[model samples]
Target: MEVNVIFSAILIFIIVYLLFSLSGILFPIDRTWYASLKKPSWTPSGKTIGIIWAILYALIALSLAIVEYKIGLKNTSITFMLLWVINYLANQAFSFFEFKAKRLDLAFLDTAVVAITTLLLIFATLQYSVLAAILLIPYLIWSTIATLLAWSIYRLNK
Candidate 1:
């Protein structure tokens, strides 16, 4: 890709991902069922997850910036970044849809989509840059645990 285009894509990815998070800034508190759920002992507190996610998202954005500046935006790299961002956004959307819209089924599906897309991002990342792939490891791991959490919530509240 052209250098300018690559940089543009990177900027767009970061901005879009930030917007996605902002769109659901109140998700944790607004989720009524989330507050009521019997969380697992392994579940991290909302504050902890928030801190982790904030750091992770910032890392992801910076990592992509590194790629854009250093590597000039390979197609594989751009694909990995976009897929990762999309899945992350989708994951947040589930919380809003489930608690606010009261659509457990749709929320379940959205969570499943996030999990699947996360896997895709991991795969795409692994194909080229180890740094990119490594950056997504926590995201993949979290999504796996989140899938289980979502399923548990659906079963418990259904």
Candidate 2:
């Protein structure tokens, strides 16, 4: 691989992880508070959630680079851009809604939006690169799970 491509991937990785990290920085998880709330019996441990997100974020960055390279970001359609942006924002919003604002209902809604946009994003990326689209499957699956978990938490806590 060209050094430029390597650098591009690294840059994307940093930017993608930074978004997730920024949410953490701003609204760091309150383990005590979270533990006090009623969660589904099936809820994953904190360490497992961290590991899953780390992997998912890496896949997300890779998918983004692949799609951008295949289609050229300059030539990417507005629909793709919109879906990607919306998904990014909605994904980040979960931390704020759930941790900072302590609003389980909003977090559940945000997760739904994230899942919907992620599905649309996968469809949009298919036109550019099937691999890129495929890379997002884990994220979509996780987001759907997250939506369900969020709803469950809201119902149990509220």
Best by TM-score: 2
Backbone clash pairs in model 2 (N, Cα, C under 3 Å; residues 3+ apart or in different chains), count: 0
| Best prediction by lDDT | 2
Q: List candidate 1 segments past 4 Å from native.
A: 1-17, 26-28, 31-33, 74-89
lDDT of 1: 0.69
Residue-level lDDT of model 1, residues 122-155, one tens digit each, is 6776556667667777777776777787677677
In candidate 2, position 44 carries an lDDT of: 99
Q: RMSD to native for every prediction?
A: 3.9, 1.7
- lDDT string for model 2 (27-88, tens) is 88988999999999999999999899989988888888876555456678999888888998
lDDT (CA) for every model shown? 0.69, 0.88
